[model samples]
Target: MVINFGAGPAKLPREVLLEVQKELVEYGSSGMSVMEMSHRGTTYVKLHEETLELARELLKVPDNYKILLMQGGGTGLFAAVAMNLIGRTGSADYLVTGSWSAKAAKEAAKFGKVNQVVPKPAKYTCVPDPKSWKLDPKASYLYYCDNETIEGVEFNFVPETNGVPLVVDMSSNIMSRPVDIKKFGVIFACAQKNIGPSGITLVIVREDLIGHQLPTTPTILDFSIVAKDNSINNTPPTFIIAVVGRVFAWIKRQGGLQKLYQDSLTKSNMIYAVVDGSKSFYYCPLEANVRSRMNVPFRIGGPSGNETLEKEFLKGAEQLGMQQLKGHRSVGGIRASLYNAVTIEEAESLRKYMLEFLAKNS
Candidate 1:
C-alpha cells in the first residue's frame, strides 16, 4: 500500500481510484469513455448534475445558495470573487490570517479597494483575535481562508460578518468538517486536496450575489454568466468532475462529514502527539488552538536544530516507500497532508517513523 501525503494533488481513497480506473475505459454502459463523450451529451450531463446534487446534500448547502461549478482553482476565485462582488461597494474587507488570505486580498485589490484587518507582526502562527478586527461597514464582503495549507494553521472560529457577506476560501479545509452554509454568501474550493483532482472548482454562492458583476469582469469569471450557464460555459473538466463526484460519494459512504471530521482529528492527533512527545526533537510552529487537522507541518530536529537534518529525514522516508513529506517551498520543513483519503493507519505509521527517526538523530 503506497501512501501519498502531498498537499493538493494529494491522495484519493483507493476504492475511489480503483472504481474510477474501471470506468475510465468505459463509463457504465455509455460505451464511450467519459473523455470521448460531449459535455452536452446525456451521460456527461447526468454526471454533472449528480456532482452538484451530491455536493448540496452532503454539504447541507441551503436552497437559497446557487451551486456553481467554476473552472479555475481557488486562486482564480480570488480574482473572480473580487470582480463579481466588489462592484456593489467598490471595496472588500480581508482578514489576513495566512498566505492564501493575504494572496486573496492582494488579488482583490486589482479590482477595487481592499481593507485589511490584521494584528501586529502579521504572523501566520495563529488566528487574529476577531474582536481586534477593523471591519469596514461598507465593504462588499468579509473574506478569509478556513485553513492554510502552507503554514499548517486553521481558523477555529467563524467570523461575525455583522451584515456583510462572509466570503471564504475553503480550498484546503472544505468538506473535512461540518460547516453551516447559512452564515456565508460565498464559499469556494479548488478540487484538489480534499475533494478530487485539479482543474475543477466548486463555488456555492447565494442567489442574490449572482449578477451585478463589474463591467470589466471577464465573461467566464463573471459568476452571473457562469451560474446561468450552470458552470458549463465551456467544455468543463468532465473527467475530473467525474472523479470528484465519486469522491463526494466516497465521503458519504464513510458516514459523511461528521465521521470524516473525527477521522481527521484522530489522524492529526497521532502526529501531534509524536511532535509534542519528542521533547525538542520535533517542532510545530502553530499554537495548539489553530493547528491544522489536515496539513501538519513539523520540523525534523526542533527549532534550533540544523535544517540540514530535514533532507536526511526525507531521504529516510523515501527509502521506506513514503513520499511527499516535504513542506511548502516558502516554509521549508515537513508537511503530511492528512486529507480524507489518507487513512489513520498511515498517520500512525508516520508517527511511528517520526519516533524512530527522532531516536536515531537524537
Candidate 2:
C-alpha cells in the first residue's frame, strides 16, 4: 500500500478510517449517514458536542478560551481574524517567518495596517530571532504561523508578547505536539493535517477576544456569533467533524499528545540523521535551530539543483509503495510530512530508499 506524505489532507490512522466506514452507511442506528443528518437533529448534535468537548479536553485549553468548530480553513481565518481584532487598533504586527505567515500578513493588510517585521520575502530556512523582531506595542494582535509546511521551519519557543494578544495559525503542526494553551490569544487549526480531514476548522480564542468585529464582518465570520452558537451558525461540515472527533478519540487512546510528540521527534530525527550523514549527498536547507519535526524538506545531491536525480528518487520511492514524496512546486526537492498519523515505519522505509538511491547514483 502506498503511504501518503502530502502536507495537508495527509494520511490518517487506519483504525479511524475503518471506523468511519462502519458509521458511514448508518451512524449507530440513527438510520442516516452523518451527512444526511439534520443540523438540528439530536444525533448530529450529540456527535458535534462530543467532538467539541473532546477537543477542548485534549488541548487542555484554558477555561477563559472558547473552542469554536467552524467552517473555513486557516486561510479563511486570516481575513476573519483581521476583521474581528483590527477594530481595537487599526494596525496589527506580523512575524513573517515563511510562506504561510507571509500570506497571512498579506491577507490581514486588506482589513488593516499590517506591520510585517520582515520587510522582504523570507528565506524560509531558519526562524528570525525574537530579539530582531520590531513589534508594534500599539498593534491589536501579534500574528505568527507556528509551522511552515512547505519550508520545514517551526518555532522552538513561544514569543513573549508582553501583554499584546498573540494569534497563531497551527494548521500544520497542531495535535502533533503539546502547546501551552495559556500563551496565546488565539490558536486556530484546520482539520486536514493532524486532526482528521479537510473542511472543518478549529478555533481556540480567549473569550475576552471574541466580540470586537468592525460591524462589516460577515455574521458567519463574527467570532461572537460562532462561539455563542456552538459553531452551527451554518450547516457545518458534519461528516468531516465526525471524522475529526474520531481522530481526537484515537489520539487520547494513543496516550495523548505528549506521546504523539515523542513519536514525531523520533520520526524526524531518523530522517534528519540520514540527511546529515550523507556528506553533502543529501542536505536540508533549514537552519539547525528551527528544523521542523512535522515536515522535513531536503535536497538531494550537491548544490545548484539536481532535478533529474530527485526525479529518480521519487520514482524509486513510488515503486517501493511510497507516494507524495515530491517536494512542493515552489521549492522542489522532497518533503516528508510526518503528521500525527504518518507511521514511523513509513519514514524508515523512505530513509532506506534514500540511502539506497544515493549509493546507486554515487
lDDT of candidate 2 over 123-196, digit per residue (tens): 67877777888999999999999999889889999999899999999999999888999999989998898998
On residues 1-362, what C-alpha lDDT tens digit does candidate 1 reach at each position?
A: 56799998888889999999999989999998888899999999999999999999999999888898888798899999999999889999999878888889999999999999875354579887778889999999999999999998898888998889999999998999999999999999999999999998899999998886999999888988888888888889889999999999999999999999999999999999988998878988889999999999888776644578999999888887788999888888899999999999898889888989988988
In candidate 2, which residue pairs get closer than 3 Å at backbone N, Cα or C atoms, i.e. clash?
none
Over 4 Å off, model 1: 119-122
How many times do residue backbones clash in model 1?
Answer: 0
User: Whole-model Cα lDDT per candidate?
Assistant: 0.90, 0.89
Query: What residue runs in model 2 are displaced by over 4 Å at the alpha carbon?
Result: none
- For model 1, the local distance difference test gives 0.90
Counted clashes in each candidate structure: 0, 0
